[model samples]
Target: MYVKFRKSSRVFLITVLFGMLMILSASAQTGAPINVRGSITDVAGEPLIGVNILLQGTSTGTVTDYDGNFELRVPADGVLEVSYIGYKPQTIPVNNRTSVLIVMQEDTEMLEELVVIGYGTVRKDDATGS
Candidate 1:
């Protein structure tokens, strides 16, 4: 009976080891998260400050610095969504690259209209020269 119990315990240990190996291999195949850095610019090659850079389908995001540069951690195969006021939004794929540069086009339709609000008032004493 003692010999039989030892054999069964060994088999159980081997099964546990096999399961752990399988889990590790699966995680490796799916790939790990990576850090991505990049810059945003307009069509004229001017840096776009405060541009939005978001991980597609997720709330994870960052904004460009004063020089239009940004950095964020994302999945190995992830997409970036970029947007700014008066500019057409863009979708970019990281493709496992650590760095990238994006150029945005202007959205003339959105910038075509403008609105201004003000209130004008005149003092009666000043107007009448009292």
Candidate 2:
């Protein structure tokens, strides 16, 4: 009985195993969902109510609690978009983080073009050209 166990063959087997491990590790890192918790507040330091928290570039999202706290599952590299009425939308990257604190800023650019000609108010889209 004879067995052939060359050193070169052993090294090749080790290298293959190492390569497979690296590939699997990298694959597990990509698009992995992680649990993230955060709080949303206004610039005035008040907890924002019913804030819309969504993962950027995706439809997955949730709403903040009445206390402005929220928890969601997001990709390790995903970005979050937080939005609320009368507030500017904010985007934040996960970057493998587990917790976040967000302060929402108010938006003042909304223009309700109301034209008053003594009694009726005409919106920009309702005006007619004669």
Candidate 3:
């Protein structure tokens, strides 16, 4: 005599197979890399184009576009630094982040003139009649 699986057993087996397929598909999609996008701007809220946005301690980097927008592929664990000439650099920590907005402040310095003489260097004030 051969033992037979009942109708409920057949239905349960089919359901399990379908569940496994769904799990595999979901895992595949989640394993794919994520694209990160963001914008960089100055304290004045103006977009800064041509700014260098790089992952800290890594060669992976991208430059801001004309609209101060940038896109990059960052790993699951990645941190980035956004920098531009004459602007204070900013470092951002990114982990599974999809988008970011950065605001950079300008470095302040006292504008002073310096004169280079044949013998030595001198400040503009020293050269002028005090």
Q: Distance (Å) between predicted and true CA of 15, model 2?
A: 14
lDDT ranking from best to worst? Answer: 1, 2, 3
User: How close to the true structure is residue 112 of candidate 3, measured as C-alpha lDDT?
Assistant: 45
The candidate, 1 or 2, that scores higher on lDDT is: 1
Per residue, candidate 1 scores C-alpha lDDT tens digits across 61-99 of: 999999999999988888999999779999999889999
lDDT for each residue of candidate 2 in 55-84, tens digit (9 for 90 to 100): 988799999998999999998999999888
The Cα RMSD in angstroms, rounded to one decimal, for candidate 2 relative to the true structure is 6.5
- The count of residue-pair clashes in candidate 2 stands at 0
- Candidate number that wins on TM-score, 2 or 3: 2
Candidate 3 lDDT over 18-125, as tens digits, reads 999999998765444568899988878999999999988889899999999999887656788888766777889776788999997876431245555678767767
How accurate locally, in lDDT, is each candidate? 0.87, 0.86, 0.81
Query: Whose lDDT is greatest here?
Result: 1
* Ranking of candidates on TM-score, top first: 1, 2, 3
Of the candidates shown, which would achieve the greatest TM-score relative to the real structure? 1
The global Cα lDDT (0 to 1) of model 2 is: 0.86
Error of 2 at 89 (Å): 0.9
